[model samples]
Target chain A: MSKVTTAANQFAARRGFNQIANRLFTGIVWLIGICTIVFICGLLFLILKKGLPELDWSFLYGLPSEMEEGGGIGPLIFNSFYVLVISLVISIPLGMAAGIYLAEFAPATKFIAFIRICVEGLASVPSIIFGLFGIALFVEALDIGLTIIGGAVSLAFLNLPVLTRVTEESIKAVPKELKHASFALGSTHLQTIRRVLIPVALNGIITGICLTAGRAFGESAVIILTAGVSSSGEMWDFSLYSPGATLAVHLWYVQSEAIVPDAQLIAEKSAAVLVFVVLLINIVFRVPLWLNERKTR
Target chain B: MQSVASQTLIDIHKLNLYYGQFHALKDVTMDIPEKAITAFIGPSGCGKSTLLRTLNRMNDMIPGTRIEGKVAIGGADIYSKEVDVETLRKKVGMVFQQPNPFPKSIYDNIAYGPRLHGIRGKQKLDEIVETSLRSAALWDEVKDYLKRSALSFSGGQQQRLCIARAIAVNPDILLMDEATSALDPISTLKIEELAQELKDKYTIVMVTHNMHQAARVSNQTVFFLNGEVVEFAETEKLFSNPRDQRTEDYISGRFG
Candidate 1:
């Protein structure tokens, strides 16, 4: 009877072990799912709590008065848009071409492999280093001074490595059969890329661009060094010689060092507005992909 | 059928292809009659697909591939020194086994071939898109939403769209490499029917593992084994009474 009881207990132990393992598996899945939802909610709640109350058209468009008077971030906003656009114009084509070479045309060789390693290294280097390089090359050597061109050029370098990697990955994600189909239809290599490959990968590439743009827009350390702190409240400027202070730099300057009576309010308002604008830009950029996903479904 | 009988579409002579040191195709020779179906049936790696790809110079795009042969469409040697591969391909279109429609709208996928050859006007493009879709037997199901993404279609419809894309350029010959292999039986039947309808206007050469498919669609059948032609005869004759025992073994499913 004792031996029979031992066998029965062992069977029960085995069943208990399976039950515990199964419960653990399901618990982990639920934990991940719940954590993701909670994190997203936390982000949205914090941004809204700090940002929504301060936003107004007057605050966005009004010119800055003296240090004591409450002023707007109009000049900083204009400068941010200008620098972001110019930087994109410079970096996008070059990075995309490099990606195409690496993905489509590059032979499997040690030299090509070395170049890929270098690009990966470039992506990991800190933004401060890029800022220093820009100051040395564009600001001092090129005699560009502290201006928008120097800052835009710096941002372009910062964006290139990331954009190139993204472009290559997106292009690679396109099925091989699509290229073969295009070729069999008598389209040349260039034609196939333009008509088939690019269109298919457009969503992924655009997402990469949006992320890069966000980085450039919010960067403080890089822009403060390359572009001067001085900003004029003009919305339109074609010349690249003007001094510009983007919104991020403005928030940093006001909060840390400005001795004005309204500096505290300005910091709070600027932080709020800045967060809102960034969120707005990200949502606007992602709208196309969201609609596309729905249509495909 | 009336206009097709007068034109000699494709003439291949003494063809050989190699991948590095491995010989893929061995001295293949054949004449593809105009606007008729010629099917290549063989075991796997018998070089049927390789020979089919050579007709449109699709092999040129592959790396480390070499060919020693003559493939001419409309009496122009496609592999000659002065010949342009792009133009040659334009005249000899191809459809693949997997349904490979462009990641674009149904209309844009069909219109891509004609657009590249400088068919710019929207009205002319619309006409070509419609006619091509109709020829491929996909127009009625897809006519309402030409702007919809091509990937939204079923597997069979997507294969038909590929055929429409190929034919929209008005090529002299169409090459299909197991074009219906990835599709279901009903889809395969529709595509085969489309192939029959297309032969009245375009010459077609197909490579298929399915002997029944080749028998049902092709007027002529070329049997190959171990990179050599075992027998070449009318489709009925080749299936009913194969001269080569190797061909008999392959058709009987002894071994691939």
Candidate 2:
């Protein structure tokens, strides 16, 4: 009787230890989760606290002044959107096609594997290098000094590898059975890609496009080297030859140069706008994914 | 082993199939008759499913698969240079073991094959969709929800939807690669009955793991072991009095 009681006590003691350990582990995970939420909330609060008061119409739509106090970011905003749209137009279709070719048509030879490695390597190359290449090609060789076309083209080059990798991975993620089903139903290679592969992979591809677009919009280093730090001072300048200074570049200049008394305000509001626009891009792209999910569910 | 050559819809002569260096199917020969249900039964890795895929050239999708000898269906060698793979696939529709319905609506899944053949009229497509689903015995269950996503259906219903999609193209041969292996027994019975009914029109060739399934539904049965044919005979005779000892042992649960 004493032996059995001792054994029971030992088992109960071990169970007690396990319960305490489990509680500790759960507490640590909850702590991490709370920290992440607090950090994001604090960052958004800081930006919007100083910025939201200055987001009036004149500050947003008025012209930038070199020496004056109340300059608007109208032209810079236009240039930012123009550059993003142009780069996306150049990159998306080409990158998606290259991805499809790699995933479906390319044979699984050593050479193809080598090509895939190179693509991954290219995706990781620093964005500054592309900016330098743009300067060399457009500004130096072509003698077109720091223009919108150079900046947009360089941004497109930076977007290409990332887009290609995303598209290829998403296409490959589709179940092989789906492709087989399509083929068994008499679809040719091209037909299967158009009807089945693209539709199924659409969500991932859209997410990729949004990420790249948001990154391209907030990019300053490439624009600094290729498109200069000043806009053409026209709110509606459509000419590719004109200098294209995006809102991000303008924010950088105002923060560092501090030429006007309102520079601090401009920088603060610009940061808010940048973060807000990026969030908008993600949400907008996600709408379609939500619709797709509902259908499948 | 052979069925009557004159009535054969699928004629195989000394067939061999290799995956890279691995010989998946050896020099096997058989003839499957038209408008009859034929079953290929064997253990896993016995090349039975591979043989079914060969009918529609689905094996061509694999990277390094190789085939030799003859697989002539309807008097045409499918491996001939002039044969269009897409056309061959159209004439020989396949249903896989796991139901694979596209993420589209039920109507769209059934309409996909017909749409590929340029049937653009709304009325004609609707007609095809209804009849195909009806023939597959899924119309009564899904008729009200044609716009619902195919993924929303139960597994058995989705398998039926796949069958409906396959027949929408109006093929002469229906290849079922273990079509009911992934289903519950009730769903399996439904598909078995459908197969029997379909044999009056389409030449049905199936690969199955269940020996009783072979005996119950098939007109003829082919037993394979290690990529070679062990026996081929009428289903009833094969079950009751298998000619080869290997076939007898397999059916009587002596060894696989």
Candidate 3:
């Protein structure tokens, strides 16, 4: 009878220990989640509180002044968009084609494996290193100086690896059965990729583009090195060879070395706009994926 | 069914296939009659599907795959250097075990093949889509929802739609690789009936694991074992009184 009582006590102790462990794990997980939420919320609140008061129509549409207290970011915004367009136009076709060749056409050889490893290494390299490379290649060697084309070309180099990797993964995710069906229906290799493969992988490709666009939008190091830290002449001057300062670079300049008294205010508003645009891009890309899931269900 | 009067549509002569060093098909030889359903039956890994894929050179897509000897369809050698694989495949369409409809509108899925073949006019595409769907007996079910995504259909309907898509190209032969195995019994029966009707117009070659399915639908049945043809005879004779001892054992459920 004594032995039986001892066994029962041990069993009860083990069950109690298990319950405590489960509760501890649950609490730790919840704490991590809550901490992340709190951190993001706090950051957003601080930025909005400091920036929203200065965000007026004139701040958006007005010209920047060298000596005055009130200055606008109109030319900076235009230059940012113009550089983005040039980069995308250069990178999208080349990246997607390279991705297709790697994913579908290239045989598994030692050389191919080496190429893959190089691409992965390039993807992990710092953006600052790309800035240095851009200065060496475009600004100095090519005699382009600090121009919009130089900056856009540098940004294209930065975007290529990301777009290539995304395209490769998306193309690889397409079902093998679909390819077989296309071939059995008498489609040539190129025809099958054009008609079936691209359409299916389009969603993932768009997501990749949005990701690259967001990264390029907030990029300052490469733009500063290649496009310079200042713009001259009229607000709408769109020459490819002219030096341009993008919004992110302008924010950095305003905070550190602007002669204007309201530099801090301009920096805060620019930060807000940058963050908001990135969030909007993410939402725009994700909505299609969500709608596709809903429709299939 | 083997009365020696029907013209041979596909003639395989001493066919041997290999994937790298592994021999997959061993000296396969068979004569498929025109306008008839020929069913291939065996246990798993028996190379029945491999042989079906070889008919249209689908095995060419695999790396390090090699084929020796001859495969002729309608007295023309398909493996010759002069023969274009794409044109060969156009004459021999295939359906897979799983129903694989493109993630597009029903009308677009049906029109995909014709469009690839350069059928661009809207009215011509509309006529072909309707005719193909009608031939596969899926017209009335999906006539109202031509614009709806093909993924929205039931499994059976999707399979039939795939059949319609295959037929839209108007191929002379159809190869089905265990096409009904993934469907329900009712869907399987419908497909079996559809195959029977299709044989009147197109030469049908099907690979199936189901012995009953082979007995029920095919005019000629070929049994495979270990990458070789064990027996090839009329369906009734092969089931009722298989000449080979191994065929008898397999049909009697003694072994795989």
Candidate 4:
């Protein structure tokens, strides 16, 4: 009432209001974060609780039963890993080469921009579309039928654009100062790329590789269309001509169409395995990089 | 003002550079003395660094950049068709404002340039690394930790390591673009002293924002403004007695 003009008193009401609002906002954010973590944990728990008891070595490596109570996914598991390795072998080098060319060697032209757009568009395309393309190329064109090679080539196609984008971004993220330094030392552009840029961008590239690897490992639709719904029924078939149904495909098959009485149990266990391995892939790839960073720093 | 006559190592003739539609440097011509330090002083965006880059053809990396000039180093026209850019760069080394030591061991950092030129022997690489580090006044401090990562060093030490790396290739000319602008005062003084010693063997051309650094380290000084050379003279005479109003005004801090 007396119109006190002290600095602290002048803004006291606003300051107090701000403090309350700040705390309220912080509380809401924390609650949201905790809820998200709880949801994820609940999902993981639901799968593991129903599946972990049934999971065992023989169940993982035994042959399937058409009308019996018990069946395993040994050949399916083998196909999953085999297809993954082959696809990576096909995609990694090609993708990284394309990425390097785009980032370092491509001239600043409209044609180059168009190519970049094409790569980005392909990276976002649906995996099912790639499966269809695989069918066109392998099943229709080459007459190979549903086979491991077809599945792997289609998976490679899916992986290529993602890998290229990730690699280009990673290389582009390397500091300009590093490139300048290398060139100043009279190193050729090719030499600088190999000796400096690749090494520096390797961490981000590896992370991209892990992410794509996880996606490809658990991929279902592509394998279903291109590799078929059945494995060769052998534990270790290395031939590319074999039917390459993977664990993810088998999980879907058991739940939807398989005649086995314990199909639900098998699906649950395989889903758990899929999630667990995806999580494991990221950790395994990143730990060595983290350790090396610590050792240097 | 006295002009000390010396053998010319680098001769620029009517150099004009354009970044697409924009003219970055115009009609720049100067003769750099052999085995002496020449400093280029100008404000930011004054084309000082651009001219320095032209010496080694580093500007070739920039897209939409065009040049019409003859930059002859040691009597060879570097811009001519027969001149291989890689070989020219090998003869003319560069250091940048920020200390950019590779993410490698200190020994490997110094050895990288030599290795690129095909010095594969362990003993030879060891010797080059030692001599280069000693030349940069960094050998004693880093000798015990030669295996340590270059990125692990302090700012000043890392800059010295970069200098050592540049020298390991044994270039005839060294171009430093604000090499000490990012360093502290003590480190700056250390580098200035190092530059003074380096001038005895290599022709050094440096572009610096610091007027004091130019006065302290350079034998010849060139003042540039708006892509034009305002004055070029011996450093001592130019500092004490100016011949051009723009150069004097810039030197006196009237306008940068």
TM-score of each: 0.90, 0.96, 0.94, 0.94
Off by over 4 Å in 3: A1-27, A283-297, B1-4
lDDT tens digits, residue span A112-184, model 1:
9999999989988899899899899878899878889889989899999989998998999999999998888
Tens digit of per-residue lDDT, candidate 4, span A77-176 = 8898899999999999999999999999898899999999999999999999999999999999999999999999999999999999999999999999
lDDT of 3 by residue, B106-209 (tens): 99889989998899999999999999999999999999999889999999999999999999999999999999999999999999999999999999999999
Each prediction's number of clashing residue pairs: 0, 0, 0, 0
Query: Model 3 clash pairs?
Result: none
Q: What lDDT score goes with residue A12 in model 4?
A: 55
- lDDT for model 1 comes to 0.86
Q: What are the per-residue Cα lDDT tens digits for candidate 3 across A108-156?
A: 9999989888877887778888889999998789988998988999999
Best by TM-score: 2
Q: Please state the CAPRI-style docking class of candidate 2.
A: medium
Clashing pairs in 2: none
Which residue pairs show backbone clashes in model 1?
A: none
* Model 4's DockQ score: 0.69
Candidate 1: DockQ? 0.51
Tens-digit lDDT track of model 2 for A97-132: 889999988888999999999889988898999899
- iRMS, model 2 (angstroms): 1.1
